[model samples]
Target: MAFESFSEFLAMGTHGPYVWSVYGITGVFLVGMVLQTLSAKKKQLKRLHSILVKDVSEREK
Candidate 1:
């Protein structure tokens, strides 16, 4: 509503590139962090499961 037209909104009065780039960088960083967390969690669970299985086998012997 503040912008007179769609072009003006995209332009953002000469600040469009900076604003959009910040948004893009933030989005990429957030996605990367989420992916990293998921991967780490999966690895941790797998390691724990293996440890538990080994312990159970040792106890059985």
Candidate 2:
């Protein structure tokens, strides 16, 4: 193996923190984007449902 031990692997010869930090930041942003998309979709569906219900009620009157 290129690394003698687990610590050595993590250190990645002094570049570990930079490389790992980038990976961490990327993961956080990706997760945030997914959550935001799901939230927006739910909000839109609720709004659409309310509009449809109002239209239907008006027609029945």
Best by TM-score: 2
What lDDT tens digits, residue by residue, belong to model 2 across residues 1-61?
Answer: 9999999999999999998999999999999999999999999999999999999999999
TM-score of each: 0.65, 0.70
Worst 10 residues of 1 by lDDT: 1-10
In model 1, the runs with Cα more than 4 Å from the true position are 4-6, 54-61
> Which TM-score value belongs to model 2?
0.70
lDDT per residue as tens, model 1, 12-57: 9999999889999999999999999999999999999999999999
Q: What local lDDT does model 1 show for residue 19?
A: 89
